[model samples]
Target: MKKHIFKLLAFSLVALLAIGAQADDGFFSREGKYNGEDRGKPVMPTQLNATWKQECSACHMAFPPGLLPATSWTKLMTGLDKHFGADASLSAAQASEISAFLTKNASNRWTAKTAPLRITEAAWFKAKHNEREVASNVWKRPAVKGPWNCSACHAGADSGDFNEHGVRIPK
Candidate 1:
C-alpha cells in the first residue's frame, strides 16, 4: 500500500510539472495576447474585395476591416451619404458589395459587445494607442495630423501591418 501511494504521488508531480511547462509557451494565454505574426490574426483579410478597396481608399486609407466590429461596419456602410461629414454616397450595387466585404472581414477578436462607428473609439484601439504609448503632442504634429492618419506613423497601415516594430513616427 505504501509503495503504491508513493508511485501515484510521483506521477502526479511529474504530470503537473509537464503541464506548467506547456503553459509557459502561451498555451493558456489570452486569445490575442502573444500572437507572434500578423499580431492576433491578419488585420487584412487574405481575400480582398476590389470595390471596398477602391472606394474606401479614395478619401482615406482603406482601413483594415478588422479594425472595427461588424455592427460598426453595418452602420457606416448604411450612412455613406454622410460619411465623416462628406457625401461619399456610392451606387446601390457598389454599396452592397462594399458593405458585404467590410462586415464579413470585421474584427473577430473584438470581444466587446458595444459597436463603435469610429475605429478610434474601439477599446482595443484606445488601449494600444494610449497616452503612455503615444505622447499627446504627437497628434498635434502636422505630419501625424491625428490618430486617424495611421499611415503617418504606420507606413504599412494601408497594407494592414500595424506591427509595433514597424512604426516610424514623423517629425
Candidate 2:
C-alpha cells in the first residue's frame, strides 16, 4: 500500500506540473528550470523541416520545438554538418528546408525570455548554473542525460518558458 501510494503521488505531481505550468495568462507558460523561454524559440528554413526529425534526431536529442532563438536555429541548421560533436552532413536541398522551419520558431523572435539551468556556455545555461562548479558533471551524468533530458528537466523548454518556481530537479 505504501509503494502504491508513493507511485500515485509521483504521477499526480508530474501531472499537476505539466498542466499547472500553463496556468498563467494567455501568452507564455512558466519558464523551465534550465532553458529560458526565449531560448527555446523555434525558427528555420523551409527545406530542412521534412528531414529534421529523421536526420537531426539520429545523434542529437530531438530539437524540441523550442530551445533556441529563431535566428540561432537558422544558423545552427545551416551549419548542421558541423554540429558540436557530430557530423550531420546533408544535401543542399534537405538542409535548406530545415533551416527555414527552425528560424521561424526559435527563441529570439519570441517576446518573452526564459533561462534554464545548464553547465554549458549557452547564456541561459551559464546563468542558470552560475553557482555550480565549472567541472560538475552532475548535470551530465548518463542517467541524468538520458531521462532528465534538458527539455524534460526544464519543462516547457521546447516552447521557451522558464520559471524557477516550477523546477523540480530529480535526484
Candidate 3:
C-alpha cells in the first residue's frame, strides 16, 4: 500500500508540472491554424520580428500575421503608405523584414482564394463573430468601438492569444 501511494503521488506531480509548463509557454493561446478550423489555438512563431512589432503596433495592435494569408499580407505591405487612411510607411529594409515575417507566418488554414486586407473582413472572422455569438450593439460600445479592437474583449489579444474562454468584454 505504501509503495502504491508513493507512485501515485509521483505521477500526479509530473502531470501537474506538464500542465504548468504548457500554460507558461502560452500553449492554450488561441492564435493559430490547426487542421481546417480557425479555433483560438496559439502557435508561437519561432521568430517574431522586432520591426513588425514596433511599426505596425504604432497605430494599432500588431495583428498576428497568422490571422491573414500570404497574399493578403503582400497586398497590405505593398501599400503601407496608404494603410487604412494612414501613412504607415516604413523604410525599405524595415518593410522588407516585416513583409517576410508576415508572409512566412501567414495562415495555413485559410483555404479561400480571396485574401482580404483586413483580418475582420475574412470569412472566418465573420463566421466566428456572427449575430448569434455577438450582439449588434456590442460593436458600437465605447470600449469596443469596432471589430479591430480585439484586445477590448480578448484579454490575450496583444500576445496573439485571442482565446474566447479568456475574453472579458468591457461595460
- In the range 57-125, model 2's lDDT, one tens digit per residue, is 676445654555554566566666677656877899888776766555555533434322221444544
Off by over 4 Å in 3: 1-46
The whole-model lDDT of each prediction reads 0.78, 0.52, 0.77
Off by over 4 Å in 1: 1-40
If the candidates were sorted by their lDDT against the true structure, best first, what order would they fall in? Answer: 1, 3, 2
Kindly list the per-residue Cα lDDT of model 1 for residues 43-121, writing each as its tens digit. Answer: 7998999998899999789999887778888999999999889999999999999999988888765555678888886
Greater-TM-score candidate between 2 and 3: 3
Residue pairs with backbone overlap in model 3: 29-42, 30-40, 30-41, 31-41
Candidate 1 clashing pairs, residues 3+ apart or interchain: none
Candidate achieving higher lDDT, 1 or 3: 1
Assess candidate 3 and give its lDDT. 0.77
Q: What would the per-residue lDDT of candidate 3 be over residues 42-94, giving only the tens digit for each residue?
A: 43365788888899888678888888878889999999999889999999999
| TM, every model | 0.76, 0.51, 0.74
Candidate 1 lands at a TM-score of 0.76
Give model 2's clash tally: 48
